[model samples]
Target: MKKLILALAVLVSLSAAAQRSQDKKKMDAFITNLMKKMTIEEKIGQLNLVTPGGGIATGAVVSSNVEAKIKEGKVGGLFGVHGPEKVRQAQDFAVKQTRMKIPLLFGSDVIHGYKTIFPIPLGLSASWDMALIERSARIAALESTANGLNWNFSPMVDIARDPRWGRVAEGAGEDPYLGSQIARAMVRGYQGDDMTKPTTMMACVKHFILYGAAEAGRDYNTTDMSRIKMFNEYLPPYKAAIDAGVGSVMSSFNDIDAVPATGNKWVLTDLLRGRWGFDGFVVSDYTSVNEMIAHGMGDLQAVSALALKAGLDMDMVGEGFLTTLPKSLKEGKVTEKEIDQSCRRILEAKYKLGLFDDPYRYIDTSRPAKEILTADTRKAAREIAARSFVLLKNNNQVLPLKKSGTIALVGPLANNKNNMLGTWAVSGDPQTSIPLLEGMKNVAGNGVNIIYAKGANITNDTLLAKKVNVFGTRIDIDKRSPEEMLKEAVEAARKADVVVAAVGEASEMSGESSSRSDITLPESQKKLVRALVQTGKPVVLVMMSGRPLALEEENELTTAMLQTWHAGSEAGNAIADVLFGDYNPSGKLTATFPRNVGQVPIYYSQRTTGRPATSEEFKKFQSNYLDVPNSPLFPFGYGLSYTTFSYGDVKLNKNSMKPNEAITATVTLTNTGKYDGEEVVQLYIRDVVCSITRPVKELKGFQKVFLKAGESKEVSFKITAEDLKFYNSELNYVAEPGDFKVFIGTSSQEVKEADFKLQ
Candidate 1:
């Protein structure tokens, strides 16, 4: 009976494979036929992606006369235009008014969430929950497709170690293994099993190459790294996204090895398509193709030709392809075959979307009310926000405040609605967001008496405020003096039994071009916190920022600290839930919190030095800073729950294993403290000997488990030689037979170790 069942399953799998092969052949034929009917001008048009001036433009350029271009068959796709009605109007021009009647592909930057917003990508990574992350993407897809958007430029899986880059808020932090896992989840959630479904949208894994490791922690700066380092440390997440079948890729603005990503043939063709086997069409980042000219590549015609040859199929918000491709083709710099290939790729995408059959399928006017921002979606957002918050400190058990306490909520963000939704939330409405003060009132009701005061502005610097307020009035300068605001806050703190100070960066402080040299809290908020801390009342600091902040002083001064990365739409409700003990925080830090800005680009997986700094004290002739400790304020995978967990010594199933054989590492985890909670059991592996130097410890696996008070459970992780593989000097992914050390515990810094070997 078992053999019969196995045989049946094998037959079903073969049948599915055969069906997929046939479908691919059919899709190819359809695209080939469509390409034959298209004119040379129309083919080039299909490669051009433009945006109308409707939504937020990340760059300065927005296409003019968009309606005429669509009607004249000069435009292929559009972004920044959403809503079923508006999208239908644009689609009508392409399908109903154009000669060939090709449907337009609508894309949007649905980064973290759609209408019902969730936490930023960095905060979502802190949860370390693949299911929750995937669910968030799924919700974003559902809401976006309902609004007639078919493509999402999301799942920014760039591994960022530098918080000063600002774009770190938009990605999974540091570790390639963890970043790769998140990349897969996000792709699965956005695309699902079928692309033809109306509920699913194509996912574009973005910033194609390393845009995160910008020099001087500046946005769009040059990135230079060795190929081995690229493969082992930075390339996994992008590879994982492609392996998960993400439909599109966006080239970054930065250059790699002196060649801009948008025009690098070795990167786009040789590495991505040849080595990794990524079949998706690549799209240029906003005006990235044009920016290559500034990178000293060449003239517009020269760069545009280079990009098309480099496997970039779409030009986003740049008319480089539309304007220069024809001349380049005529001048023999580019061939018609190359143009046809790009045209074919775009047409294939439309066919996969079932656009050829029904161009207006996603334009149902009734979907917005039924699918967008429903009660169920908002509830999910609230729950997910609570889980993303990390408890950095809780001295004397200051958190989980009593419902009957007289609480003072004072800070710039406490009652503000403009900054609730973090950066790149293009579709979310800030006016609909619930403020911290309002959320506390709703949750605490009559049991808690909550007093509110405007402690200080988000920042006192007018120049910085103006730069941040480009999108909106994010950091509003109050007419009242800073001293007056501080005085009001101190008075409120004195009257209350406990104080909850809401402070941190404004929404625009850590995204896109918002990089900062100094990553500490603004002096205005720092002074506000200092005053509140001196009131002799237990102060619970609810810190909100998009990236890991330099919080050494704040952590030392505050009674309790919650690192909430601009929890979106339901942020207020979620913060209230955690503060009142309605939910226990299960989030762990994805990025290391630096003690100071001097320790920029700090991460747990640093290569072992000849003379390593083993302690906080600086040693002469060692790799240590004299003024400050080498340690971070909080290490990666570090978060404190309301309850406590203890791990027993690691027990191995075997001492040695072959390349194919698996070894099991087991540890008994107990909820030692008095509350039920979830703990992320992290597993790190160290290569005792290698041809090339490796990191002291690399994250291999992790498991999040829930345990009741005093309950003990045996947790196990299976390891094979595959888990030990790394890119060597030759850029070959291989695992050497040698001794290995395994550490299993709560975070990177705190763990228990055992030994193993590969034969």
Candidate 2:
């Protein structure tokens, strides 16, 4: 019977391999026939991705003569434009007017959610639920495709440690393991199983190499790190995305190892394509190919040739390829084969998207009303937003505010809808978003009296406001004086039994080029918080930010604090649900919150040094900060629920295992508090000895389990030798026989440890 079953499995596997080979042959033949008739100009045009100036332009320039270029077959793809009608018009020019009659691929940054926005990527990561994260991406793909988009630039998988880097809001935080898992989930969500599906858009994993680890946490700054560090710490997420079948990649604006990522052959070719076997087309981040000229890579024509040779398939919003690639080819600086290969990749992408078969596959015009921002999508957004919120602090159980209380809803974001949708929500409409006051009223009902006050403006600095307001008026300064605003908030707090201060960064304060040196509350809002606290009222601070903030002062002042990462569209409703106890806050902190800006790149997974600080206290020559402690204000994977959970000691099925064998680790988690809640049970492992130094602890596995009050559940994780593997000094991925410590915990810090070994 076993032999018969094995024979059947072999047959099935053979059949699958044959089918894949057949499919590849068909694709290659189709592209070859198409390319044979294409001229040099047209082939180079296939590498040109132009964005018409309707949506957001991250770069300085939008494409000029876009319609004429598309009609002339000088443009391969179009982004920054949506809607079925608009996309159909763009596609018509490519297919109808162009000589080759090729279809134009439509792309968009469908990051979190489309139209019906969810929380930022950082907040989404906080949920620690891969299924939920995948669902969010699925919904985004559905909505984006409904609006005629076949490609999505999302799942920015850069593993960020520094909260100062604004784009941290756009990624899964810190840990490569968690980031890699989310990357896979997001890719699966966006692309689904088949790219040919009209509802499934192609997912683009972005910022190709180490854009998050910019120097001094500045945006678009240079990145330098060892190859070992890259493989072990930063490269995992991008690898995971590629492994999950992401259709495309976007190169970062920053340079790697002093070479611009757009022109770095070692990274783009040697590592990504050669090592990882990524077959996807590579697109440069908004004019990044052109910007390489500034990186001393030479003129436009020179850099264009460099990028093509480096394996970058498409130039985004930059006419560098359109204007200079033909010149480079004529000068023999770039080969016709290199150009052909790049064009072939882009054409393959279009073919996979089913664009070649039917240019208008995604253009229904009817899908928008039925699928976009519908009641179901909004409900999902609200539910997702609630789960994305982290209960930073809840001293004396001050949260789960009574529905009957007279509550003071105060701060710049209290009644404001403008900042609800966080950064990079290019498609979200602020007017459609629910404000905090409105949400409180809707959730609290007639039994509760909700008095509102604009405590202060998001910031008093007009210079900073101008930079952030490039897209829209995110930080709107009020007409009233700061003193008057504070007085009004204090008066409201006195009248109410409790205060809910909605404060933090405006939507544009932390994304793309919005990095901050001091990641703390603006003075205007800080004063408002201080005044409200002085009212002697129990304050429930609803903090909205794109990045993890330094809230040491506010933590001491507020009775309760919730870190809501600019909850989108239904931000108000979601905040109200958590505050009113309709949904318990289960979102953990993906990134660590620093006590101050001094601890810029603080994270839980640092490699142990010979002179490592044993505790918070300072010691001579020890790796410790003199002023601040060696710990973060809020550690990664830290979150609190209305209910309290107690974890039992970890129990392992075996103390040692062979390379091929697996072990099991189990822990009893009990809900000791009065409320039912969900807890993210995190598993971490440390290699006691190895070929090279390893992180003190690395997250290996996790499970989000739900328990009712007083209920206990045994959570187990299957551990294998594969989980113990890491890249050594020689850059070989292997697991050496060594002692290991396994930790099962709520957060990285608070955990029960058990010892094990791999033999």
Clashing residue pairs found in predicted model 2: none
lDDT of 2 by residue, 1-759 (tens): 999999999999999999989988999999999999999999999999987784334422234478889888899998887888878878888899999999988898988988999999999999999999999999999999999999999989998999899999999999999999999999999999898898999999988999999999999999999999999999999999999989999999898888999999998999999999989899999999889999999998889889989999999988899899877888889999999999999999999888888889999988999999999999999999999999999998888999896999999989888899999998889899998888988898999988899989999999999999998899898898988988999999999999999999999999999999989999999999999999899999999999999999999999999999989989999999999999999999999999999988899999989999988889889999888898999999899999999999999999999999999999999999999999999999999998798899999999999999999999999999999999988899999998999999999999999999998
Candidate 2 residue-wise lDDT at 292: 92
List clashing residue pairs in candidate 1: none
In order of appearance, the predictions have TM-scores of 0.98, 0.98
Off by over 4 Å in 1: 54-64
Question: RMSD (Cα, Å) of candidate 2?
Answer: 2.2
Candidate 2: global Cα-lDDT? 0.92
- What TM-score should be assigned to candidate 2? 0.98
Per-residue C-alpha lDDT of model 1 across residues 1-759, encoded as one tens digit per residue:
999999999999999999999999999888888888989999999999998874324422234478778878888899988888788878888999899999999999999999999999999999999999999999999999999999999989988999998999999899999999999999999999998899999999989899989998899999999888899999999999999998889999999999999999998999999999987788999999999999998999999999999989999988999999999998999999999988888887888888898898788899999999888998999999999999999999987889997999999999999999999898999997888998898888798989999999999999999999999899999999999999999999999999999999999999999999999999999999999989899899999998989988998899999998989999999999999988999999999999998998899999988999978887899999989998899999999999999999999999999999999999999999888899999999999999999998999999999999999999999999999999988888899999999999999999999999998
* Model 2 misplaced regions, further than 4 Å: 1-11, 54-64
